[model samples]
Target: MRTPPNEAVATDTVDEGAGPERTCVLSRVVRPKDALVRLALGPDGQVAPDVRARAPGRGAWIGVDRRTVDEANAKGRLKGALSRAFKTQALEIPSDLGERIETALRQHALDRLGLEARGGMLVNGAERVEAAARQGKVHLLIHAADAGADGRRKLDQAWRVGGGGPAGLEFPEPRTILSMALGRENVVHIALTDAAAARRVLSAIARWRAFIDPDAGLDGGDAAGPDAGEQIRHEGNA
Candidate 1:
């Protein structure tokens, strides 16, 4: 059976010289920065999600899951963890930290996608995406959450024909959101032609999915989640 999209899988092995790893305050598991979300205290003593992991001051790392965050809050574990991590008991934990983190992750992923578009590393439309897949030039495929099944299947088949194209990601964002990000109308599918850009997009998507549904694995291969046929819709060429 395929793994559920919301099930948290074991962290992928981190290679040497990648970066420093941190322990999750909730799970106590050491994971790479991409596998965890960072929470930092602001000057006002309020806790905030640092999705970019570049916030100043001390930060506490936690597993990317709503349950883990909720459990920590309910058991007062997050409070204690923050106190210890920041060396202060005056920190304030927001009641909606989990929701905030979810929003931040989504925005971060979209921002990266926009960057890829601006850099000319992104391609859209079924025909263009399919052509790139057939040529094995697509480093990553991103299908909108509500993309049509027929189009997705055709592209997937072409990708396989090209000796198996790179991993495909089913983004949770709807077509409208994706369209807006790429400055196009009705963007249902996207292809990342540049390897570096694809990696950046994949990392952002992995972090966002991990936070919203920790059980969802980000193996960078087949797309997973809700059925693509449920909200099928065709889009015009780019």
Candidate 2:
């Protein structure tokens, strides 16, 4: 999951190299930063995810799910904090705050992809995956690793045009990632990104992949999360 800095500290720690652990507000225990998303009430009094964590104002941190937030809201933790920070009791938390945040984050991620493309991040089409494989230009395969057999075959035909990946490469649903990340459309042919973005994307996929993989670890991940490295092989297909 993509988490902002620690929420327990309740402030932006974007460049804080305090090592892997930070404190959680709800639990009051230091934990991995990856476990939370920083949220701050905007000027309009709407709660949103602080993706960049640069928003000015006193921020409150929380895990990136609705249940925890709902719990905090019920208990008035957020209410008290807001009352103290803005020095007023007249504020509103949107009824659909979680959905709102999800939508915003998704849009931001998609925008970043466009920004990357505008900045010269290449996104090779179906045919280029093969070429990328032979020339080692391929850093990732952005296909629906779980698509139907015929769809996979057709895509693979185009995918192997250049020396693409191996015979049995797999992928994930580009649209799903787009929806989750709030992008333009399905992200079927994404190129590799910088280490930071790539790590975040890959980790998010791990949780998704674990849901469908029968062999997922207890933590519900397979590391890179069902990328092309693992291809399906039937008894007679070689």
Candidate 3:
């Protein structure tokens, strides 16, 4: 079931100097750039998602939630919104805008992970991650969606023992996706030893999660639900 949109709720606190705030054309709520998805009209008269928020020219910013996009598409609100936002009625709204945005978000997160890996800030493999956790060198722990319960518990315990690392974060992508991202064979667990890299990866993941599931708390608390880990295990087993 699709979660209902919380466009009326102001869940995010404004961060000064983070960037210029943009108003969601659908909900009329002003929020930081991180909390919104930017859409730009191309020269071909087609609208495309600018997930990186780097597209040139005027752009329409929408709240970071799938429901927002779905609703706008369903009610033909996007056409009107784009026309007003860009001051053009010739723009074309793609039927798969939502799906494209989702794919872009997933790719963006994976790309960030790949960059972190290249920077030597990320360590993979269960044993290596556990060792980093034990040494208190891990600033963030990332567990693949399909990671086994035993492996996850082992590293969780190690992180607890180390006592300074943040709680283990479960990536929504499976082990295969994680492996491909880091150019590894079978990545089930990863540790971010550098604080800056961890924050960058976390920010990317948070933006994707917020777009897919707005209810997810991006601050390491109940990303999906109270039983997110259990749900992941169940899905993996299935």
What tens-digit string does per-residue lDDT give for candidate 2 at 147-230? 345644554444344233322223333456543443334444454323234333333333223323425431223233223333
- The candidate 2 region of ten consecutive residues with least summed lDDT is 3-12
lDDT accuracy of residue 131 in candidate 1: 91
Q: Which candidate leads in lDDT?
A: 3
| Candidate 1 TM-score over all chains jointly | 0.83
Question: What lDDT does the true structure give each of the candidates?
Answer: 0.71, 0.43, 0.71
Query: What is the TM-score (0 to 1) of candidate 3?
Result: 0.82
What C-alpha lDDT, on a 0 to 100 scale, does residue 59 get in candidate 3?
92
In the range 53-107, model 1's lDDT, one tens digit per residue, is 8899899998748867877887898899889889999999988888899998888
Q: What RMSD does each model have against the real structure?
A: 8.5, 11.3, 9.0
Residue pairs in collision within model 1: 6-215, 7-215, 8-215
Higher-lDDT candidate among 1 and 3?
Answer: 3
Model 2: lDDT equals 0.43
Model 1 deviation from the true structure expressed as Cα RMSD, one decimal place = 8.5
